[model samples]
Target chain A: MKLYDYILSGNCYKIRLFLSFLDINYETVPVDYYPGREHRFPDFLEINPLGQLPVLVDDEVKLRDAQAILIYLASKYDTSGRWYPRNPEAMGKIAMWLSFAGTEIMNSSNARLHDMLAYDLDADKARANAHAAFRILDDHLVEVGFAGQEWIAGTQPSIADVACFPYVALSRDGGIEHDDYPAIQSWLTRIQSLPRFIDMPGIHFMK
Target chain B: MSINFNKYHWFAFYASQQIMPAEIRARSMWNTDIAVWREENGSIHAWKNRCPHRGMRLSYGFIRGSQLVCLYHGWNYEGATAQCSYIPAQPNLKGPKTACVRDFACFEKHGLVWISTVAEAEKEPDFSDFGEAEQTIHFCRSIFVNESPGLVGEILKTSIFIPYGNDLADGAKLKIETSQAEHHQTGANYQAIWQSGRDKKKKTELTCQTEVRNNAILVNHYKDDQGNEGSLIFALLPIDDKKTGVHVLFSGDFSSQSLTSAKRHYAKWAKRMRWSIENRNLQTDSFNPWI
Candidate 1:
């Protein structure tokens, strides 16, 4: 298995973190996503048409999106069957959050891009959208806390948490603060406390 | 109303549980950056967020045993004295005494962590009204609101809370009454006399009182008709000119099942209260989201 990865990219870190958690031996094809912008080059675009940071190539299966890569990795490698459960209800909820992580939560990524990489994007709008998404996630976590559950989709840690964890944890890079979202803060701590957990550039190691 | 927290007074900015052991959290108040962390031995410390070495945010550092190791260059600061304990580059040389993060007076009480801006504090904020020794304390949540502490206090003066554990009816409006001040130096006391007056013909009065002690602590006591009572302590922390954080703790004799339910109920209420305050729907008077 070869994963095209970027050190600073949270999406790519999600794949790297999950691979470490699953104890899967995968070769990392480093991509100069920062100052070099190699992902946008023709050679990298051949690997992923969308020119994204993380493109997982495992034997014959090729995945483009980070969320899709997470689903694929968990379905194939997670022998414990707890990361991506087979239950229908759990799958539905996890899929919904995965969709949210790719769409709404990506606003935080865009904001970070604007701030850290000096990308020409609407940082204010991205921060506002990120705050809106954090509000929803925080409220959902509070509701789940009422049921005595910690993980996002279910009781156990799922790919949904991995998909959404990075951008929210790295929101401060885009000037987004977590002071208002106490529930989300607690959830981040719990995610960091998981076994085989790893940290990237912006996300601090809690334990 | 502007609150000058630069003086020597203990203000509770966060719940005790929020500061996990062996974890570093960045907290700010009155434009002063603070790094509040807990040791593995359960001892809590608050110091200036900046590292004396390179002005790096000490909050961004990690904890090793009782020391906060700076992320920039690995300068270890001791827990109790905030003195420089170790330097990774020069292993044998002792760090200078002046190379220390400025410390503050910190204490944990009533399920909340209190911090004093000055190093020497004559006394901690006395929350004698709650009598926490007699009741079980449950931290509800710490809510960050986009408003001044003074305005938040004013809103609390006339704010109406939802019923706790199906105690009051759904649409019953709880009216608030502002009583005379007990004393100014310590804090003002407002008797939040609420009347469930939705149905004017069948008016039911549910008594609840709020006490503002030490200009930071707001003690709210709610009693149901069936004698099921709970008190919520709102410890407000003024972050800056436009932001305030309210740490809430519930003290009552509740069963395990009822405790969780009551915490959920109050947590939702606190969230809605923040929404109301942020949206300008709540004010000193004429603010009733329940209606």
Candidate 2:
């Protein structure tokens, strides 16, 4: 497996974190997503036409989108069937949250890109949308917590949790503080506590 | 009901469990930004959010054992004294005495963490009304309101709490009447009477009593129709004039089986109260419910 990754990109870090959790050894093709802007180059564009930082190539399988890659990796590698469960209800819930992570939660990622990488985007709107998404997630977590469940989808950790972890953890870089989302903060701590969990530039190991 | 909103009173801000070890919670209370963290030994500390070395938010830092390490530079501050203990750059030298983070009075009580801006506070809020000595206090949730604490407190006085148990039916109209005509802005104290819908076949009435220990704690005692009693405690933390945090905790004889659903029920009530209070003005008959 070869992953086109950027150290600072939360989207790319999502893939890297899952790979580490699975304890899979893979090669990395580092992309200069920052000042170099190599992701926009012709060759990099050929790899992923979306100009995204993370493009995973696993043997003959090529995947884009962090959530989809998470699904593929979990289906292929996670023999334990805990990360991406085969249960119908569990898969449906996890897929719902995966979509949420890719769409609504990405606002935090956009805001971070605007602030950290000086991307030309409306950061205020992104932050506002990110807060709205965080509110929904925090409320859901609190509700589920009342039922004694820890992970986002089921009783166990799933790719949905991994899919949603990075941007929310890195929201501070975008000035979207987690102070208001106590449940989300607790969930982030749980994710950080997971076995073989790793951290990127903004998100650090709690230890 | 005269109470001081400025200082000397312990205000509950976050739920106790939210301040986990090895993590920092940044909060603002009484115009001061506080960085609250707990040591691995389970002792908690709240200090000025700014690091004396470079004004970096100490909350942005990480905790290593008994020390909070600044992110900008590896300046470690002792959790006990908030004093700069070590600097990686100056490994051979002891940190200067001036490099200390200002500490605040912080403690946990009644399932919530309370902080006092002043080093010495009057006393912790009294939770005897809820029988804290015997009953287990369950933290429902904390809601951040983009309004004044006074406003939130006023609204809470009239805020209806549906019984967590199967005591009250849906669409039951509840009206609140307070004994006092006017409540002081600093703190509140009043007795309330909650009357259920007159339309019900058997009208249920609850005499609600509120006790304010200090400027922040509001204990609402309720007796349901079935003679079961419960207490809803609201600890208001005035983050500033505009921003306020309301931490809700409930105490009752909840069986182990029913506790989880009870918590979920009250959490929904708290979130609804926040939404209504925040959007009361924009609410109209024509208001889009889906929006």
Candidate 3:
């Protein structure tokens, strides 16, 4: 397996973290997504017309989008069927939240780009939208906790947890604090404690 | 009797199954911040999220046994009353009476955790019409909408023929029997009866009651037919002026197939409703159903 990776990109980090959890060995083909803007270069554009980082190529299967890669990896590799449950209800939930992480959470990542990478955008509005998303997530997690389920989708952690984890854990980089969302804070701790969990630049292992 | 903070009846805020841990949870209703928590002994409490000591949100606090301790200053509040019990800063000095957090009346029934700003009235919002308490209750995931509860109510009243998809019998036709909206001093109630199936003898009757209280809407549904007799309740919580949280619960003697089908059906219906509410460009006039 080959991963077109960016060390600092949260989307890239989600793939890295999930791969580590599955104990899968994959060679990293580094993409300079930041200062060099290498993802937009001709070579990277050939791999993905969208020029998104974290493209996964496993044998004959080449995938774009972090969420798509996650579903593929979990379904193909995870024998336990815990990471991406096939049940209709759980799949529906995971799919809904994956869209949430891609769209609403990507807005927060845009705010992070403005703050950390000096990208030109309305950081305040992006932060506000991120906070709104966090509010909903925190409320939902509280209910999930009450139901004796520790993961995002079902009784176990699923790809939905992985998809939404990175941006929310690194929200502080975008000037979005998790202080107002205690349930999110607790959830981050739980995700950090998962076995074989790997850390990126912003998300750290829990003590 | 106007639709203010005090006139609203019991409003289901969260599912009972979701309040599993003994921790403080934050929620909003009609733009009012609320901190909901369950004690270790399984008692639930809802209070104003604001801390009286320093105006910090109590939802950011941690729970210790039966007390909620403020995150900022460690001002401990008892679970039931939300009265200040101990202050870490001034342990010897008794916590002042004025330091108590404003608490709301909370109750749990039919797999729902309800909170009300006012005292309980002579009679609670009736759920007895649904079913008995011991039946299996399936609580669906809540959906959030970027629309007012009144607007959602009007949409539901006017658009009664929305399909249930695979949840109904094959080739079943949905027909609205009676649609009525009665306005009270506090809020309004929209009631409608819908029947499905070409065979009138075996037609499934679905009765819907939507109560628009303050800024929230509660819809209770009763279904009776040859195959199933049960009820489903929906509680809409207004998080702010532009956002609403919807909680759903189903109670009845249901087969596993019907339960799974019901969950799938409502989840899609909610997504569609939310999209229509957010994108539709309709008249902004007051929701007067009589006209």
**TM-score winner:** 2
Candidate 2 structure quality by residue, lDDT tens digits, B1-291: 123454677888678788877778888886788888888888998888999999999988888999999999989999998999999999999999999989988778877878887766887766665733578888888888887877777667544455565333344444444445235443334333333333455545555556555757777766657565687888888887787898888987677778987887778778767777778778652111112
Alpha carbon lDDT at A93, candidate 3: 94
Give Cα distance to truth, residue B185, candidate 3, Å.
Answer: 10
lDDT of 3 by residue, B162-194 (tens): 223323434444444434555444333433333
RMSD of each: 3.7, 3.7, 7.4
- For model 1, the TM-score of its B chain against the native B chain is 0.84
Stretches of candidate 1 off by over 4 Å are A204-207, B1-6, B120-122, B131-133, B167-204, B224-227, B281-285
Which structure among the candidates has the greatest lDDT?
2
Question: Which of 1 and 3 is ahead in TM-score?
Answer: 1
Candidates in descending TM-score order? 2, 1, 3
Clashing residue pairs for model 2: none
- Candidate 3 accuracy as lDDT: 0.72
The interface root-mean-square deviations, each candidate in sequence, come to 2.0, 0.9, 6.5
Indicate whether candidate 1 or candidate 2 has the larger TM-score: 2
Runs in model 3 with CA error above 4 Å?
A: A1-104, A112-120, A124-160, A169-207, B1-8, B85-98, B119-123, B131-137, B157-230, B282-291
Candidate 1 overall Cα lDDT vs. reference? 0.80
Q: Which CAPRI quality tier does the interface of model 2 achieve?
A: medium
Output the lDDT of residue B234, model 1: 80
* Tens-place lDDT digits, model 1, residues B98-207: 89889888888877778888767658766665834578777877777888878887666445554465433455444445453232433344433344434544443345
Instruction: Estimate every model's Cα lDDT from 0 to 1.
Output: 0.80, 0.81, 0.72
lDDT agreement of model 2 with the native = 0.81
Per-residue lDDT for A101-135 in model 3, tens only? 99988878988999999999999999989988887
